[model samples]
Target: MLRYTLMRLGIFAGCLVVVWGAVYSGIFPRGFGASNGLWVLLLALVLSAPISWVVLRKERDRASVQIVTKVDRMKANLDANRSQEDVADDSARTQGQPS
Candidate 1:
């Protein structure tokens, strides 16, 4: 997950640089005086989103699978613990042990 996050951030940073260059070269229009930086950032985000989505599909899927596997493992552990507790209780009852 962290790897995927960092990769996405790298894509965004790359897009920011490209957009910054375009704006400076007059290929893209700059924002109204006070909003120029914000404009560039937003444009970079918009451009980066699709780029990251397409580029990072495999990484995203791998991260998702890791998460799912971890969750399943945790669930299995919980089930195993519950079964052990049940066996302990049953043994105590059969032996007439106190509660």
Candidate 2:
């Protein structure tokens, strides 16, 4: 997951550089005055999204599988713990009852 996130960040940074270059060289129009930086960031995000989607499909899928496996393991552990606790509680209740 960390690896996938870093790869996505790298793609976004690359797109940001390309977008900045285009705007700087006047090939791409900049936003009004103070909004120029926001414009570049937004364009970078838009461009990076598709590039990352195409480039990172495998990594994304692997991360997703990892997450699902982790969640399943946690759920199994929780169910086991609950069952153990219930058994302990039942034993304690029976021990306290009259003969």
Candidate 3:
């Protein structure tokens, strides 16, 4: 988990480096007379972190819910199996009784 986290952070930092490099290299130029195309790129970069976080959170929640549902189903099946066994045992005991 730590390795995965570090890798993800590294990739995010690499993207920022590449973007800034492009701007510094004059690949991104001024536009609408106000902020510039660089401003738009920066905004997109800033937005990525929050968006990724929200998406991950939602997926984790969904996975947790699915896991809980599966566990409940398994428990219910076990209970039913136990009940069936009990019924079979009762029937056998009655059959073996002296008339």
Q: Of the candidates shown, which would achieve the greatest TM-score relative to the real structure? A: 2
Question: C-alpha displacement of 70 in model 3, angstroms?
Answer: 0.3
lDDT: which candidate is best? Answer: 2
Higher-ranked by lDDT: 1 or 2? 2
**lDDT per model, in order?**
0.97, 0.99, 0.68
> RMSD in Å for candidate 2, one decimal?
0.6
Q: Per-residue alpha-carbon lDDT of model 1 for 69-98, expressed as tens digits?
A: 999999999999999999999998889965
TM-score of each: 0.82, 0.97, 0.48
Q: List the residue pairs that clash in candidate 2.
A: none
Candidate 3 lDDT, tens digit per residue, 1-99? 344455446556665666666666877654466666557467446755675565456555666787799999999999999999999999999999999
Q: By the TM-score metric, which is better: model 1 or model 2?
A: 2
lDDT of 1 at 8: 97
Off by over 4 Å in 1: 91-99
Output the TM-score of candidate 3.
Answer: 0.48
Candidate 1 displacement at residue 12 in angstroms: 0.5
Candidate 2 residue 97 C-alpha distance from true site, Å: 0.8
